[model samples]
Target chain A: MRRVAITGAGTINPLGHSVQATQQAMRDGVCGIGELDIRDVERLSIRLGGQVKGYDPDSRFNRQQLALFDRFTQFTLVAAEEAIAQSGLDFDGGLAAESGVVLGTSGGGLNTQDENYRAVYEEGKNRVHPFIVPKLMNNAAASHVSMRFNLKGPSFTVATACASSNHAMGQAFWLIRGGAAKVIVTGGSESMLCFGGVKAWEGLRVMSKDACRPFSANRNGMVQGEGAGVFVFEDYDHAKARSANILAEVVGFSMTSDAADIVMPSQDGAARAISGALKDAGINAEQVGYINAHGTGTAANDKTECAAVSNVFGHHANEVLISSTKSMHGHLIGGTGAVELLACLMALKDGVIAPTIGYQEPDPECALDVVPNEAREASVAYVLSNAFAFGGLNAVLALKKA
Target chain B: MSENVKDRVIQIIAEQAVLEPADVSMDQSLSDLGVDSMGLVEAIFAIEESFDITVPFNANEPEKSDFDISSVASVVAAVEQFVAEKSA
Candidate 1:
């Protein structure tokens, strides 16, 4: 297996569109949650959500590209453009044609689906939009990215609910390690702010009526959010040969299945993923200094994640500084792991750990020091980002200082 | 429809659109207050729920609205007209 390094990254999130702006917002402890502004579904009780503001799809793609891609795919393409520019790789060159593209998304083209439904049902229209098929599929985002950059190597979209991005990133890391591709553009995208998407979650009954308060005593449920985070992963030596800027090393990745309830999370499942990543990296549990938690601000998730940490690290759990960006950005579903991983990498690079905002009162079940509300400067060598999704899917990624 | 029914419908539209009680008047267009045609559809939905009446949309009508509906008096007249037609 070959060592993989992160060459570039881009994000379109609530804090801001660029990666720098997002990190600053995290350090400043700004909350992006606001009242929902989606069309036609205002009567729903759950009104608060974190939406990516001021995004113009017209600016991202040309008319021809827009006709074939969905909104999620458009987000992927836009984010990938930023990442590709940062990597300084020439996509038209043969080198990039062999490179691959893999992305993850839970609600792909949900906005398009809702629109199509309304057209057929409410408007009494029979003919569907020509782009409906391409817009509604999970793999469309990856396909669009590959075509946009002319990448020819293995490419696909991973769908494991919230853990989708972790799975996508993990697969991309392995592709390079296995010598299948020298470079891979991998990440996740989500646009669940659409009225139908919001209404679907409303049926789940797990979304908070108020704001997201992760690991807080007053926490009710998870808050929905939308965005995309993309990364360019290349072979360490390949990046060095080209004098590419290395952000952080993708040390190891591990995934596990809960094999139990579909909606409920399990500490054992999460612990197994942590242990697997540590084993893969050949690092002791004590070597890891920080954790980017999959803290969804829900009653069950925060407690289960804490227990999972305790089960894996034992006494070292207290020494480790943990935080959740979800408290600031809300839960971005498939995009959460990618965004949180960037936070972990930034923490390892800059030594400034992002805060878990809105944590006023701590839950006794969650005993770890969550670095609440205020960003703290700490020495971090190895950081782990955890993404445990619905249906017991768990994925973990470890990033080391480059 | 009775004047009280018209008033109730107008009140629901005003509240749903986040407008002031006095801002909504008869002959005033809803689109001028940033409530576009789709917003008007949602406003009608809310009003229907509040008044326990089903407000129907004319399929042949143009997508865009031509008037301003900022004041309650004007909105009341529009709802009254729709209600009277439905009953007839």
Candidate 2:
């Protein structure tokens, strides 16, 4: 198998609109959680969220184009634009045709589906909108991304709840490693922060009351966030041939299904995933310098994930740095892993470990070195990004300094 | 009252259902556009939600066998009738 390298990455997150801004915010230990600015919050219990500020679709797409895409697809396009630009690899020749896209999301076009349903049912309308079907499909983001850049290879969106983006990126890395595609624009985007979407999530009862304090003793639940995180993945040889601006090398990818429960997570599944990723990379547990944990700040996730990490790394668990960026950026759901991967890449390159911002009093169960509330400066060669979602889906990726 | 109701109802219907402003004339047949039974139900839901008014009668099941809900005028009249019944 060929080695895969991350040439570029981009994110439209709550902390910042771009990768550089978000990384700086992470380094400064800045938290992006704030009061909800949505139109109607009085109807919902959890009003606060990590919504991306100043995201105007009209800024990127024309009126006609905007009519065709949902907010999620619009975000995917915006993030992909930045990723392509930063990759420093022009697709003017045959490269464009060989490139593909694999995007992910849990609830594809939930807002669009809800709106269309409301329009048809409440407004006494007979004819549905022409763009409703196109907007509501799960593959809309990947299709739009591929079409925009003239990428002719395989394109699809993986839907594995919160693990969707990690699964998408993992598959993209494998495809490039297997020499199926020269480059893959892979990531996840979500904008399901509308009234209907929030109401549905409220049913889950995992929303935080105060804020998302991952690994904190007082951590209530995960805070919902909306944004996009995309990365350009190419074979090491291909990227080196073009002298592309390499960001980090994807050393290993591992994904597993717990097969036990849909909502409940398992420590064994997470440990297996971590061990499998280390084995895939031909590296031992000691080589992993940092772990971008899936600490969703929820009661079950933080404790189970911490146990899983301790099981895999043993004594090194206390020595290795672990942090949950979700504390700062809120839970991006499908986009969480993509943004977290970018954080891992930044940590590997800059040697600055991002803090688990909301960590106040650490839970005894989560006894690992969570890097606490302050960002730690340390040289890291390899970093792990983990994402475990509902339906017991687990995806882990290993990244090395390029 | 007839003109105002027709104009307001038609605009809301067109915008919600994504119909062309011109296509939502007073005489267009909604059923002809392949928007069968479910479409009618959704149209009622949107009308109620957007206008912040509940239409009279259980939209869950329709008693009328052959109500024409295709045009702007018919929908306006239906909503007005539903409104009047609730008010009475």
Writing each residue's lDDT as its tens digit, candidate 2 over A43-104 gives 87778789898877777789899788888888888889899889886666898877899998
lDDT of each: 0.83, 0.83
Off by over 4 Å in 1: B1-88
Candidate 1 - chain A - TM = 0.98
Q: After superposition, which runs of candidate 2 have C-alpha atoms over 4 Å from their true positions?
A: B1-88
Provide the lDDT at B50 for model 1: 59
Q: Model 1, A105: alpha-carbon shift in Å?
A: 0.5
Quality class of the docking in candidate 1, CAPRI style? incorrect
The residue-by-residue lDDT of candidate 1 on A2-110, one tens digit each, is 8999999988888778888899998899998888888875666678998888988787677887777777777777788888899998767777656998898998888
State the DockQ, from 0 to 1, for candidate 1.
0.02
Q: What is the lDDT of candidate 1?
A: 0.83
Candidate 2 residue A144 Cα shift, in angstroms, is 1.0
